[model samples]
Target: MAAITYKCPNCDGGLVFDPSSQKYHCEYCLSDFTQEELESLSQELVHRKAEHQEPGLREQERREQDRREQERREPGGAGAQPVLYTCPSCGAQIVTDETTAATFCYYCHNPVVLAGRLEGQFRPDYVIPFQIDRQKAEEIFSQWIGRKKYVPETFYNKKQIESMSGVYFPYWLYSCRVDGELDAQGTRLRTWDTAGMRYTETTVYDVKRQGTMEVDHVARNGLRKANRQLVDSVLPYRMNEKENFSMGYLSGFLAENRDMEKEQFVLDVQTEVRQFALQSLQDQAGSYSSMQVRKKEAGIRDEKWSYALLPVWTLTYNDKARGKIYYFALNGQTGKICGKLPVDRKKIIILFFSVFLPLFLLLMTGGYFLG
Candidate 1:
């Protein structure tokens, strides 16, 4: 397929898709067109209307017809351009009409992506482009693996470590305002004296509490198989750096749409929201010698949700003796790293006996001798 380029109607300068506004904007003349207009023109040339027409094909036929009709309104019918690509190697989806000289697969770590297949099957809203390039990622990975004394030496070598990728993991970000109210019993202890004897008394009081908090950008994992715990451990991404979505920045990297829907993540989000509400409500209770929450009610409201692709780098290594896999995760955006590694049982046992045992014996000998 030829490299396609969209030209502006007013000035004929090159036009590019603007993800922030979801419009095609011409950088030269500043003319803007909706994505529908741009797509209709590009699809017109390839569409020949599927071979067999069925009886109940009315709905599909109508939508197709409407799109075709809009194509006629486009300025250039025959010369419209395409702006997306698909990776044949790993099924990575991308959008960049310009040649991506080099590309890597996020899932399979393949270096090949056929240029022809990237004809607009998948698109992304925004991309947090690779701030830490491949070399930087390797450096970070090595420093991380070095701290693991029991990690196999082979795992940190160049050949094995190059497989590390700067992948944009998918996620769903939800922003909402929360309001909650809770009631519980609070207790306090007091001492009383009667004649020569003293007795202890317990006092209980009714405690009522209410609180409100606004949360911005609570993220839920969009990849079902992804370990949320691992993702969270590397968190505190610089959310302010996030850009509005666009396919252009995905030119040489790998990304995927959120296969998991917003509804599927509600249960997980509710769990976090409840914990946040509980903490805020507890703070409002001021000072209580001890408090037991017997009954609780909390709620979430004014929620805004959207699918997002966040960045992460994962490294997995095998431990021979235990025959279990250990993994480490790095937050691609903020560079925070966290994960589990192999621990040497022999070293642990030796250290315990060599250090702690002698210290314990010395303490006992001193107590016996000095007593």
Candidate 2:
């Protein structure tokens, strides 16, 4: 596997994608390049990589091959293996699991994209790049934390704030057309008083509705290892704003490859679509005093599936004493936020006592004066 990094042509420093400016920036020399300029440079690097091979990289590949061979010889030894790649900037070994498609080198802090992991079928068709930058995300997090009274201080400290990361999560987008019909019975009641007597009438009518609906961009998480609730709560990225997938967008962010396939979600998505269509037809049955649905039929066709990468800003805190993990996530495009924060029990107990103690003293003094 080959690890790739974008280097600034002017200063030869590591380049990272800047969400605020939508450009590649070199932090060392403060230089920025547009996508067109970087495309040419990347092509040149590709040619150079094909021609030259580093000795350290060759050694790492040899070791990996040996490890695989040994695993094959041993029974019940085949399992997930770590991959190793040499960082071009620092010449240090970068270790990653099979699912990590993009990450930062621990030694040099330069972003590295594992090209092999994103090749062929694993490549995403569309990507929603991070619209909320690190600074904006941090500001939003600070404001949210400030509103809470009993949250622990350690959860929003400087170190924890810096640990927040921008990640591109894999999702499967589904679109389809549904043809549906619904049959129902509706009833209306009429009551009146005439000549000092009560009269009542009930009328019943048969209702039928038919329509076609086109549903688009129903997204489902594609990585099985990801926390479904944490990611799903921050939804709804602007699908209309999604751009064509470009490796450049993955430069500064961590990205994961999909472990779950579209086939896995096929039945669920189809059922959801059918239910939605039936509900729409039912709603069109008009306003009646009472209604009962008799039959509903829906047929789905022209199904389309596309793999996409959506952006999110995430922070996690592990409460080791409590054996629990808390998460904070924000939608990268819409600025929607969701979090599970840890409350400080000590702070709550102190607050409870302080308020009641003052009230209790006031009550006792008032009673003494009355007596």
Candidate 3:
């Protein structure tokens, strides 16, 4: 198999996959390809005999042909037509198929995100947009520290807080249908006395449950740095709000496509999907004292996928004293917060002396008086 490289249809320059638009785009010629065109072109090259050309040359041709075919079938591909934007400061380039309000520069991390970029290929089906902006995110972080008794004074002050940033993390959203079958043996204990003697008895019942669950959208983080639990705690995002992918929405945000492909997570995700489906079944089970799930099986059905951007605010802090890094995450959509905190050993010592000393002294005085 030859490696493929897409070239611009217009100018014959290199092309690459544009996640925001879900298309192959040419930076030089500014042309787009749909999924159909991309697929068809991809297929033709695979079977078609190549002339006596170098492997590199043949690979490049296949890539360009694939991009054109992709644009034909993919709705988010070039056919919808997006406007491209370039940043003068960092030379970061972006394109949006629809109108967007803001855009950011991927190269220099500029936040000049335009307001109109959310309507097109950059648009998110649903946005857990930046409800906790940088400033507010700092405040929330400081408050989180304040809750910790005996935290170092340095940890609470504005100097440290100012270093915090609200970063928008990228993630993938998946939708699937789930069917679950679970079997277990439930045990009920009974006690009875034979005459005056005590007797214990137990009864076991075979339990079985089968159900269907429709999972609308399950999200998995695309960035390696994004903490899975912290990101998940902020759920559930309003998945219903997701719009088709448009490049415009990406204009102003720090966005990334899934670093890990969709198939990589299917097994891990199956558990969550089954849990959701089983919740309904357990509710239906009603009045069981305790249910033990024994044998269980889940099958994902009617699976369909779309790439989307969810929202999160992440901050990383280095603790010099502890020689470790601490992270804080906030749910961009729900404002829920979860993260690790630095514990000060000095403060713990102070707390112990303050509380335990007085208690010990009082105990000693009472003993002396009583004696």
Best model per TM-score: 2
lDDT at 80, model 1: 33
Worst 10 residues of 1 by lDDT: 114-123
Evaluate all candidate structures by whole-model CA lDDT and list the values in order: 0.62, 0.88, 0.60
lDDT of 3 by residue, 249-272 (tens): 333345443334567777777777
C-alpha TM-scores of all predictions: 0.59, 0.89, 0.59
The list of candidate 2 runs beyond 4 A from truth reads: 47-79, 192-198, 360-371
A best-first ranking of the candidates according to their lDDT comes to 2, 1, 3
Error of 1 at 11 (Å): 24
| lDDT score at residue 116, model 2, on the 0-100 scale | 65
Work out candidate 3's RMSD over C-alphas: 12.5
Cα-lDDT of candidate 3: 0.60
Give candidate 1's whole-model lDDT: 0.62
Report each candidate's C-alpha RMSD, comma-separated, in the order given: 11.6, 4.0, 12.5
Q: Which candidate is the best by lDDT?
A: 2
Comparing 1 and 2 on TM-score, the stronger one? 2
lDDT tens digits, residues 67-178, model 2? 6445533645652567678997898999887578899999999999887667667789999988889999999999999999998999999999999999999999999899
Query: Could you give me the TM-score of model 3 versus the true structure?
Result: 0.59
